[model samples]
Target: MKDLVIVFPGQGSQFAGMGKQWFDGNRVVRDRFGQASDLVGYSLADLCFTAPPAEVTRTRFAQVSLLVLSYAMYEVMTEDRKIPVSAMTGHSLGEITALLAAGALTFEDAVRLVKARGEAMESCVAESGTGMVAAVRMPVADVEKCVEEFNSGGHDVQVANYNAEAQTVLSGTLDDLKGLTAHLEDRGAKVVKLNVAGAFHSSFMADAVPAYTEALHEVEFTEPTVPVYSNVTGEAHESPQSIRESLAVQLTSPVRWSAIVASLVERKAAVWVEVGPKQVLKKMLTGAVGSGEVHSFDEEPERVRAVLDQLVELKKREPGLVGLCLGAAAATRNRNFDTAAYDQGVVLPYRKLQELSKLDQETLSDEQKQTALDLLLTIMRTKQVPEAEQRDRVESILRRTGDAGLRTIAGALAT
Candidate 1:
């Protein structure tokens, strides 16, 4: 509730036994894994929790597995734990997860979409012989410069992911990644070759675009109920079309991660919860914000409960702390906590709403008060609250405004 954002990690976050506890204990978690397995024609639980490292890490398996686990965790957080999120973002494959959580896509559609995406990317990797490498302790600019210099004459290489301020991943032909290592090391950057099939998020993925776009077109999209940032632009998606376009571009574009983190910070997101199988995103986010603010929920009930409890206490102290609970990361948008706001028959304490929304309580005009109430009603409706309930809450809050016409208008809306 404390101006929090939920982030989902990408493919490499997977490991043997990831999400095993949830699969063992939670029916909802197991059910989701089953759903994914049925859709993908393989046991996702086996791949995510029991498979050999090599097999689980395959691009095709890794993508769907991460989505299933991340969404399961998101389900626990929202339905069971009731955590509130303000915004959401995801890394690479994680971006699909983000879109799912934002209401831009459905679960069945996402599963099919990511499956197609992974297969497409895997085919590209297999056919092109492209690879990826991570460069650490180097500014993103320096990493880009190194790629440009190495690519100026012959080979094709580009920055694949702007992961952090001083860490980036590069993608190119396998030989090109090897070729650039020495020059990067000479510049004091630690370069390690990643064990990935193809150069994802690079021009090598161009062939994967059309097919994935077709899958995307088959899915229905709605504007996000809560702000969701885009990995392509590192900003809040302006509309459903923008989200769709960005998802398509993400196939052959570098992930603008560091910029996304900075954007979240600018938007007043203070605490970051990484909902996935591992702490990969939490570690990266810790570097962006101080370590005290990031929590990683992998499948440990105690750890997950501890973070949820912490956020609940936060909400208790600041009842206005808006929490955007993700129903399913990359599938469902903010759900439970937004209800927590309106369930009280008011969005927030008058003074707190003024502070958070930056609207003056002493505003001069009745029309402005009506406008604010209308916007709140619209948001509650977008969250899909029943019409009668939304209007009741809005009318309850509007009663505090001493304007007769405003209360009458609220009554009219309730009808």
Candidate 2:
């Protein structure tokens, strides 16, 4: 699906039996758990499937288990389906999952890195005595003002996550956060203490960053196959170095989730898939883009699959040879050519393709379809589009349409 965005959830989304369905139903998931256990020196399957809530909620266990499960679900969902993911992103710890899914990091590297990151954060919690609280039904500006007051008072509190328009998370020493409750309540906001270990995404997490950066340095990052939005920057990472740097600072930097959602909306993201435990990201997406279609794989795998299948069928039905010609003509950007020859070679063919696009697909004869494909090829050639890109466009169109004749033509072009 075009403009499909895949999102992953971070900490606070974990629970007992988070990935039991995938663990039991898919061999690949089981294998991933097995491999992850070998890397982390613990039975991740047992941790996820049988552990108690308290045990599973520990940061050290929660982070790696969540990543493994999320990655497994992503693999299972996309193994057979050619989902054209326009972009991918995750919240906090989920960013690592997104990186792994986008091929920026290997499975082994991700497991080891997350394991180290979780342990480092747990250590930070033990040393710092910090905590987090969710401030709901409050505007972010007000939250920032409250945090500024706290910081000005030398309390070291900060806004950790801009989750939604009306929800923000604050992180600091437990006493400072507890002190905010009455003040936030005075402003008609609800303050709920989060069940987390430390003040993540704040100065309290500074101790965790050095070790996490070391862990990051140990891994070799590559370019992602798809655009992966960064939580630290609220934008797509420009390079592997930028990914590393953003991740290095992510421990103490606020998660700009609202900005990320806004960017996705600006990009015209149509369908959103949350490939992690619970519907945490889905709820946030709904808050940001009201009535946006979001499918949570962890909460409803069958429904997500059905929805995706429907999308594939609809895509196949809507775009025919005429649509393909128009898409190809639009995609070819090279324009350095002779003006007179271009008018006769490209302009006339494009007009014909536009005329053909208006009529019903069923009414178009095979000859007309062939003519449309020829016109698209002619336009590509006149525009000086590279042969490889032209082939890719034609093959993509053929796959979407399931047109055997077009596939034959595409195969001939491949040669």
Q: Per-residue lDDT for 23-78 in model 1, tens only? A: 88888899999988899999987787677988888888889988988998788777
Q: What is the C-alpha RMSD of each candidate to the true structure, in Å?
A: 11.3, 7.7
- Highest TM-score against the true fold, candidate: 2
In the range 333-399, model 2's lDDT, one tens digit per residue, is: 9665799878987889899999999888867877787778888888888887888988768755643
Q: Give the TM-score of each candidate.
A: 0.76, 0.79
For every model shown, the clashing-pair count is 11, 0
lDDT, candidate 1, equals 0.74
TM-score of 2: 0.79
Angstrom error of the Cα, residue 147, model 2: value is 1.9
